[model samples]
Target: MIQKNKYLIGVIALLALALFTVPCLAMEGPDSIELDSLAELYEPVQFDHIMHVEAAGDDCSVCHHHTTGTPVQDENCIGCHANSGEADEVACSACHPANRFQADYLNKIDENYRLNHVDKVGLKAAYHIKCMGCHEENDAPTGCQDCHTRTEAGDKMFRSGKYAPKGGNKSRKSGH
Candidate 1:
């Protein structure tokens, strides 16, 4: 009887340890994440994930929605996902498609009647919306250059630097 009691206690102890440590393990993430998904015209953003995590007070729901097993805080999402639980993947790109305007992606969204994600923004828009909203609220920088440095390709596209309009916007005389 005593041997059985000892074995039960050991199992209970192990279960308790697992329960407490599981959440911590789930919250663990890389210190930094290189954001290069939309780095065509701009350099990749070296995102300091740890810093944002601290700024968010370690609340994963702030950015991850209800994917981190945290309660849904956004009123728009609370209706359908109040108790939806943790997701298999939490990365923004996992749900928000990069080629959201593509014909196939549009068709997929159109066919999925059960998913009420029709209004969901694309990956780039998602990043901008989430980041810019927070930055605005916290009085952080919202300028394009504040987060992303334009690449040489971007400069050329924008007609800036060496690509600036030659002759300083000279007016062309129309021959009548």
Candidate 2:
């Protein structure tokens, strides 16, 4: 039977890539930080998702990680959640580059972030406009909770750690 119809179409494409990358890693951003030990100056140290999705390979779209109406393009995490100016982009001056006055005062505190009126910008100015502008253009820790936190430092950065393939810590879940 054609090998059981190719094993039922490879178990229906691995159950439609786990219903599209398990809710895009169960959506995040409740001040997202599964364990950023503060030390990646330019390219190394965002680990702590149970050690980067299980030693960098459990596949959450394999770094191509994405969200917004999924398609599961090999597990796109959009190379670190795209849209900072697109193209190989990681935004926030793509590594803090408005000429570094402390990443230009945290990009002017992310263009004067607000809160209640909602023009708000707290994730430490969207994570210093994207992970301390690439760890301060490769220097790291722009201080201030090292990335913003309020309620008891977001409950001590969500109890510090322990996300593995068994749920991969989505922080709060918010994708479709």
The candidate maximizing TM-score is 1
C-alpha local distance difference test of each model: 0.86, 0.44
Q: Tens digit of lDDT per residue, candidate 2, span 1-176? A: 99999999999999986776564442332222343433332222243444434433444433323433333453233454454222344222244333333566566657767622223343334444544554666576677455444344444455442321355556876786
CA displacement after TM-score superposition, residue 12 of candidate 2 (Å) = 2.2
Which portions of model 1 show Cα errors greater than 4 Å? 1-26, 169-176
Error of 1 at 142 (Å): 0.8
RMSD of 2: 17.2
81, model 2: CA deviation in Å? 14
C-alpha root-mean-square deviation, each candidate = 8.3, 17.2
